[model samples]
Target: MARPHDAPSARELVAAVREFLERDVLGGLEGRARFHGLVAVNVLGMVERELDLGPAHERAHAERLAALGFDGDAALAAALREGRLDDRFAEVKAALEDAVRDKLAVADPSRAG
Candidate 1:
């Protein structure tokens, strides 16, 4: 009865988790309790979900590079042909994560406190 998905719907799943945590786990947030508390926990779950598959993603990247005959130590040597690894997929992904701190600060300025 469920439609197929190309990948796990992390956003929807995280949103649902947020709602669950807000309503059930913490329950009627009061006193010092805040909704933002759940954001930290839920965001970390999303981050860990991403990190847990990093090795697989790296392996796939290596495989692709190998298939393209750009591999191993030789690939490191030939890396200049593609130039700076700083902008490579892996680096871009890292930068995206780094950007999160800034974005979160923008979203919740008090988070900087």
Candidate 2:
């Protein structure tokens, strides 16, 4: 039988991850450290998915959005032209937001470095 929904529920994962990132991981670290780590992990899982999909998906989306007359080509050209980002916490987020806003996937090139 074809299953429409077989994946683990987001609610469950969110609750579990939140609890873990907050309680378990935060238990030892200081406030700022804990919060940074928490955000990092939360972001990591989400970013990992996009990274895994990578090029094939990017091309597919670029093709579709171009067909729909969106500026996907422009965005992609920008991405290709965009240089490597500096290694910083804020830079990571800035990159992600930029890619997302441009309707392109942003994969963390460096995961938990």
Candidate 3:
């Protein structure tokens, strides 16, 4: 996970772009262009959060699924749909909620509450 480079890591680079878009690009636009710039900023924010948390989130998700006797998300979905997790519904629900929150944290943490 280590980058063999010097200063200005990938996260820093993304953050710089997002900041530019927010401070410069958004200020010069109007109507649709402004909307598009806002969307771009949101996308960049998601990308930044993903870069920061994706690996850890995936590890936690896999661990949670395995603890419930599933190999991965697909397997977990199958079991849920087939009622295979009926006995552990509460536990599964909690795990799923946590996973969703983790994703929302990356997609838009402000709405996570």
- In order, candidate lDDTs are 0.55, 0.56, 0.91
Give the per-residue lDDT of model 1 (tens digit) for 30-75.
5456566666556755554454544664675566555444656466
Q: What is the clash count of model 2?
A: 0
Candidate 2 has an lDDT of 0.56
- Which of 1 and 3 is ahead in TM-score? 3
What TM-score, computed on C-alpha atoms, does each candidate reach? 0.31, 0.36, 0.92
Please write out the lDDT profile of model 3 over residues 1-113, one tens digit for every residue. Answer: 77699889888999999999999789999999999999999999999999999999999999898889888888888888998889998999899998999999999899776
Residue 65 in model 1: shift from native, Å? 2.4
59-86 per-residue lDDT for model 2 (tens digits): 7655554543356556544544564323
Q: After superposition, how far is residue 45 of candidate 2 from its true place, in Å?
A: 1.7
**lDDT of model 3, residue 23:** 92
Candidate 2, residue 7: the lDDT equals 63
Candidate 1 colliding pairs: none
